[model samples]
Target: MSEIVTTRQQTPGDLQRLDEAPTPAEYLGRMLSDRPALRIGTRTSPMAMAQAGTVQRLLDERAGVASEIVGISTSGDQWMGDLSKLGGKGAFLKQIERALVMGHVDIAVHAMKDVPGDVPLAEGTALAAYLPREDVHDVLVVREGSKYRSLDEMPPGTRIGTSAVRRKAQLLKHRPDLHVDRLRGNVNSRIAKLDAEAQFEAIVLNASGLRRTGLEHRATEVLSTDIMCPPVGSGVVGVQCRTADTAIAEALRLLDDPMTRTLITAERTMLHGLQGHCNSPIAGHATMTGDGQLSLKGMVFTREGGKFAYAQEWDAPDRAAELGAYVAAVLLRKGARGIIDGIPH
Candidate 1:
């Protein structure tokens, strides 16, 4: 597996000042200079920068363009206390998007799941490319000497940790017998906490995160997407850029995975249609079939675990957005509306 080569570290003092930051024109001038380089904006986290580097490399290879990264601090990174209790999913992405809009950087790379379903980029700004999707399942990283492999394998009253209401709702729906507790921190920190303390018997993390960090050794079991439908666009990478910048857009377009984008469009459309946010216990996944059609699957559940609904739909690639809306409507008719409306945002 290819890994992200860049590390997330504080920018050297020389590069920290905005006065030191070049204008969009200046940056593009540098790119078209005798030594060309594309600049990608990303949050300053090991996992995030790693993902950014992966995209940078792909853009370099496929577009015949060299690139470098500019690590930026996002609101989500500054205030890690309570995501939902703060300002919702937008906290994770707003600053980064603002940087793009302000021309601080030419491109922005993001984890698709962290991005909200209804991102309101300026009319001329859009997701430039979608990378190949990785494994979309959740995984249980159990404490050493623990016998639990799958979520079901955990005993009654077993304490599990997770920050996502969607994962908590889904896990409880299947195994109400287990205990779900709150968890926070970067990937390595979470694992260290779980390993060093007895607060939780295990913690649930995205398989893609583990794989990206080269920590797959900790996975006790990969929870099937069947039981744990992934959050929208869980394992994909998306690059955002100004729509008017046709050269940069075309450069990024080379890294776009058509199948991945088609599937993510359906999943994101379903999320947008349901008016779902990170606070809402919603999970959706869409797959592109061999025959070139898109198949969608999704679930919406209540916070109290009282009500739940699932829906699946299929359509040709061209109708990806329509397919997602139809599936959401189906789930809505089957009591999903009640669950969505009742859930706290």
Candidate 2:
């Protein structure tokens, strides 16, 4: 490991700042006896680093902890050139989680959607907490000067692009006349494919992706949940650390937003119970109301949207998991299982 390097010299304003900044020694003292540097393992992608950096900054401000990002190239980033071909979810998180289990990182930060339902953390490792969510909607980006305002408005046979089976199925179900195609890459790369190659008439992308990459301006239309329910845990940030590392968990506690976590918990449970992943044609969304209740909306659809199965909203914090399970059961009862099993797998 290299010595910790500060990019900028300490200035009067930085020194006087009362937001709680810790020296390297201070942070290291709490971590291990040798006080090795705090290594935050993360994917090298721009968006991944941005998310990790945000938490690192907050750790300093809120907990007086200092750390550095240890960029690790994962399989997901390596094969960004072709994602759809790589089956299943957890594509982006497996390597990072492995690094954590191998003691390369003290803590791991992740976009909740990318994390697998089955994470085998080392004996003492555990998920610390999840941060608040961002907007959970998919956006449509068409070439400039396009008169189409919605998917229904687009001409039949229009080429639609997406990397997720969930989105492809949902959109096709709504507009059977349109054609869906595979799109894979970072936000910038996807945009290039659309603009340069004109390979797709429009692309369905997570609204949060656009915000994270500062490309929201390209969004021609934001599809609501009514049109396209987002993937489970789409916009939440999750933090994981060794379960024995009480100090790190306590330090990260302040970052947890309980209400957001509660709602996302239901969404994730729904996904898990349904055995769904990035490649599955599954979509669900959850929201918490001021009346101290949780509401969840979920759906299962075919790739071409020829048929769909949906479940009603369930409101009950204590039964959040049950609510999700109930929805899946409902979908199963509605012939969703047959449709799901029919996929080419």
Specify the highest-lDDT model's number.
1
Model 2 stretches astray by more than 4 angstroms: 1-37, 80-87, 118-123, 144-149
Candidate 1 lDDT by residue in tens digits, 129-248: 999999898998998778777776778999998978888988888888888987877788788889899899999999989988889999988888877889998999899999988878
Give the clashing residue pairs of candidate 2, or none. Answer: 124-243, 173-305
TM-score of each: 0.87, 0.85
lDDT string for model 2 (1-345, tens) is 989976988888877884467554445335544455568888786777888888888777766677889998878877855443564456677778788888889899888877665443446777677877888899999865567757778898999888888888878777878889888877777887888887788888888878887889999888989888887788888888877777777777767888777887788777776765344577778887789778888888877777888887767887788887777778788887787777765
Q: Judged by lDDT against the true structure, how good is candidate 2?
A: 0.77
Badly placed stretches (over 4 Å) of model 1 are: 1-36, 290-292
